[model samples]
Target: MSKSKILGSTLIIAGTTIGAGMLALPLASAGIGFSTSLLIMAVLWAVMAYTALIMIELHQHADSSATLHTLAKQILGKKGKWLASFAMLFLFYSLCAAYIAGGGAQFGDRLAQWFGVEVSATQGVVIFTMLVAGVVTIGTSTVDKVNRLLFTLKLIAMASVLMFLAPNVTQSYLLSMPLQQGLIVASIPVIFTSFGFHGSIPAIVRYLDGDTPSLRKAIVIGSAIPLIIYVFWQVVTLGVVNQSTLLENQGLSALIGTLSSTVSESNLAGTIGIFADLALLTSFLGVSLGLFEFLGDTLKKNSANRSQALNRSITGLITFLPPMCFALFYPQGFIMALGYAAIALAILAIFLPIVMVSKTRKLTTDVAYRVKGGHIGLATCFTCGVVIVCAQLLISAGVLPALG
Candidate 1:
């Protein structure tokens, strides 16, 4: 991969990872406290990076032309492929739903504030979902261009918020100890939400011309950017917002509102809101495109050449409908749903790669970029799988803190 390709791939990965969730990081990190959250974030980053490295290695060893589904099929056989496909489908759909819901809530709030109208959140979601679907109906290339633009805008908005909020930070906030009970469990969703870029790995690997070195660099550098951003945002948010405010609000907009009250300008709050809407929109579109591509490929392979219209319609419906319903009915629950999706994605994007590489050990050559501490690396991957499964159970049982 050339430097420009590396840069492009990094932007795609970072953009995909940094959506909607970053807005919620402060609230998510508050329960664990700042220092503890930072430590947890660091550990999660290392784990995610290692898993991503393993994924690249697996991709290198497998048929370069294979999609993620086929990759799973090759290793875990039909059962594994079914599991991986189901998990990924569920994960991406739920995530798209969250994005739609989040975008709708933000759009409605902003619209209501601006126009003095009583627009419900559901109405907002419907309007935005139509907009996204219409744009996607045009072409995939348009969505790609939009993702790049949104990535740039998201970075600017985030940078501005950080800079605007930085002076308000106090040393005491950074050094505070975390609350004891449920902190470990609470950190699960936050970590899961932050390190989510698994959906794009195969496309990224293929985009780099299937070169192992390029794929490794893209995953490492691409993932690192978001981790750094998450940590920085967590620190700034922790310093500015108190625990009481966080617990009471449990949403990103509310947290920003509280933080902005301490600053001299209200414009920063408005800017953050607008930027968040863009970020969520970008995320929704990116994931939606990926889902469509996956569906399209599956249909073409299974149905032969006669199912073009049927394929397109089914793809559109699958990509749009569930998310649209969730957006309309459960707009407020978007962030929590996103956390759930992230956990599922971690399984497909992180755990399945390790399993694939382990099963296809014959395909891996001595020259490939292998993970260090071979058996230990495999052990760590297994531990992450167990942790993710347990975390999912706790989250489902309502035992973890519900941070937006």
Candidate 2:
């Protein structure tokens, strides 16, 4: 692969990984403090990156055009394929709901601030979902081009926010201890979801034409971009904003509001809001596009005789409806949706990759590239996935502290 293709693949992975999910990072980590958050993020990043390489390994055993669905079917049999399909749908829907919840609140807040129009959460959800669904309906080429533009603007906005907020950092805030250590468990679900570019691995494999060196580099470097970004984001947000302020402002809207109010500089505050909005928009575009495409393919497989327009109409409805309702009914569910996404992601990204790779290894030794660490590495990744799922369960059961 040429450097340009490598770069494009790298950016795709990075773009897919960093999304509206990160907006909830500070809120989730606040109860655990900055040090622990950094440690956990690092561990999750390592696990995710390793599993991504494992995915590439699985791809080498299958056809170049094979997706996770096909890989699971071929290596792990029909049962695995069904599980993968279910997990994928669960993951995509959870993420779409999260972005919808977050984006609607951000749009509504923006409307009230910019035009003095008080849009309700339901109205914002409708507007936001419609706008994104319209773009998705236009198809992938349009979405890809638009995503690139938005991704660039998002990076610029993030840079501006980080620079502006740097001077406001308080050493004491960064050094603070966890308010309740058990909340650290609750943070796992959201944090793991933050590194969710595993869905793009098969595409990356095809894009790079299964060049092991290129795939490994793209997986490692692409994933590292988000890790570094998250570190800086944690530093700026946690260093400047008080733990109490972080804990008090729970939802995405409240988090953005807290950032704006905590900062003294109006320009910096405005940049922070813009960055948050961009994060949500870009994430929604990427995630909703994935769901739209998935639903389209599914509809075609079931009803190949249907007209394209009719198929698209059904696909669009399936893609946007449930998530829109979730956002409208639970407007403050940005973090909640993300936590659920983490569970499904653990199954899709972590567990399946580990299982498929292990099965492939047992079946054949002829592999272009294999992720290192053998069974021990696979066990470690599986353990991490279990931990994430259980964390969400414990949080739901009130066994773990859900607060920041």
Candidate 3:
């Protein structure tokens, strides 16, 4: 792949993975103790990397020009297509809603702090949702351009914040672990959420110009970047904020607030807020664009008129409404719901990758990337995904506390 293509793929993966979840990861991991949380993070990275490789293989058999919907139809048939489409739609829309509501609440909180205004959280959510909807409805080209700009700004802001604070993270704090049981389990959702790059697999594959080797390298490298950033961010956050405060606050933005107080630097809090918001916006836009792409393709393929306007409106509504409602009534649940969705995505990533690898053959009978352990590698990936999903379901069902 060319430098520009690699850069684009990395941006897509990073933008998709960072989003609203980054704000919440530290708080979610607070209960699990830092060591256990890091362990879980490592496991998720390996699983997602393997899944990305599987997706690359799957793409080899899929039509290079086809979108995820078409790929699903080809790989799994009609029912499979419907199932995959529904899952993708549900995942992205729910996430967009969460981002809108969560981003608004965080952004509003910062704005309120800065301006001394009292804006209701729900009002903030509505404002943010409208902003996202307006941008998405305009066109993909506009969204793409906005994402690229935001992505650049986000990286700069995050790097600046991290660099300034790097010296303050004490060695003792880095080594210490919070005492909690279910915290790790509860945090699985957030860990999985941080690795939520599966939605971009099709685009990554396509961008590689359908070169299997290039696609494999891109996915692995792209996914690894976010994982490293996430773990390092968690370390910094944990070191900066006390575990008790993180647990008590139970939100990433809240943790940032607490850290600001501890550091006695309001500017640090503001910087984190600005960068975090930018990251969330880019992430929401990327996922929204991908969702719109799949939906637009599906509608055009299945319907006669292919009414782009109608499609945009419906897609906007689907992506906007539910999370807005949840934001209004249950804004705090946004991160939790996002975590659950991540687990579900992990399942899809693992299953689809292995299935595609097993079913497809090389065009020239020369495989570019092969699973080293063969059947054992496949089973390990499958089992890891199953366990993650089951654990998540249990956590969500109230049968288990996520941390426990």
Candidate 4:
């Protein structure tokens, strides 16, 4: 693949990984050890990156148009298709709800600052969703191009924020809190959600025209962006502010608000909001691409079909509606929605890849890259997935308190 195509693919993967999830990371790492969280983030990145390669390995030998819908049917038959399709949609729906909630709140807050007017969270959700719907309904090429630009903007915004903070950091700003017992363990599910980039593999395959080397490199490089960003983000957050401050606020906006006043001439809050908004937009673009294409492929109404536009409409509505409703009605459910999404990731990104790779390993053309360790890695990853599911279940059952 060309450098431009590779960069675009990298942006899609990295952009998807670093969204609403990262917004909550500072708060999520409050009680947990920052080093522990970093270690967990690294492991999840490796696992998620490995699983993505498995998806690509499967995609390389299949039709160029094949997606989650196509692979599940080819590997696991009709029953698997039903299971995979529902899992895919359910996960994306949960993620969209979280993004809408996150984006709407950020957008509303910034707009309110700019105009000296109050924008309700529901209004924010509707505004963001309508704009996102326009981009999503247009299809992948547009999303790809738009998201690449958004990714660039996201970096610029982040760089600006970091630069603004540089003069403010002092030796007194650095402090380490004692880790609460069981908090590190409780944080795994939330941390796992931050490394989610598997859903974009099919889009990568299509975008790169099935260039295996580029796909592998893209997954690794794309995933690494979040890892580095997350580490730097947590380091800045943990060192610059106290855990008590994070505990008082439900979201990162509070931190941004605190830091906003540090500079008199600049609208730091608006600058921070731009980063959050761009992150939300890029993530929205990617998950929408995955969900719509998966549904369209399931119904056999892909870009090749005469009714492609109409098919995308149907797919976009199916993918976007439930989240829109949730965001409008329950605008403050960002953290909750993300916790639920992490629970689902155990099944879709974790367990499913293991099973798919194990079942299809024999069928894969030797030309494609295979997940190393064969059955051994699958067994290990499945065990890890089970542990995540169990932890999530604990949180759901009130055995463990949910983190922010």
Highest lDDT: which candidate? 2
TM-score of each: 0.91, 0.96, 0.90, 0.84
Off by more than 4 A, model 1? 264-266, 299-314, 362-367
Evaluate model 4: give its TM-score: 0.84
What would the per-residue lDDT of candidate 1 be over residues 1-404, giving only the tens digit for each residue? 58999889887787778887777667667767887777777777788778877777777656666677888887788988898988988887888887887787777777778998667767888877878876775678888787778778877887888888788888777776667667666667656776788767878877887787777778888889988888778767788767766767776557656776767465576666667777788878888887787777777777775657667777777789888897677667676677778667767866787777777666546745777768787787678667766776687688765556
Candidate that would win on TM-score: 2
Query: Which ten contiguous residues of candidate 2 have the minimum total lDDT?
Result: 260-269
Runs in model 3 deviating more than 4 A are 1-4, 114-117, 298-311, 361-369, 402-404
Candidate 2 lDDT tens digits, 94-128: 98998888888888888999999998778988998
Residues 243-288 of candidate 4: C-alpha lDDT, one tens digit per residue:
6766666564675665555554676646666776787777777776
Query: Could you tell me the TM-score of candidate 1?
Result: 0.91
Query: Judged by lDDT relative to the true structure, which candidate is superior, 1 or 3?
Result: 1
- Candidates 1 and 4 compared by TM-score, better number: 1
**Local lDDT at 156 for model 4:** 94
Q: What is the lDDT of residue 189 in candidate 2?
A: 95
Error of 3 at 200 (Å): 1.8
Encode model 3's per-residue lDDT on 338-404: one tens digit a residue.
Answer: 7657655764677666765666543334665565667888889888777777777878788767531
Residue 402: error of model 1 in Å?
3.3
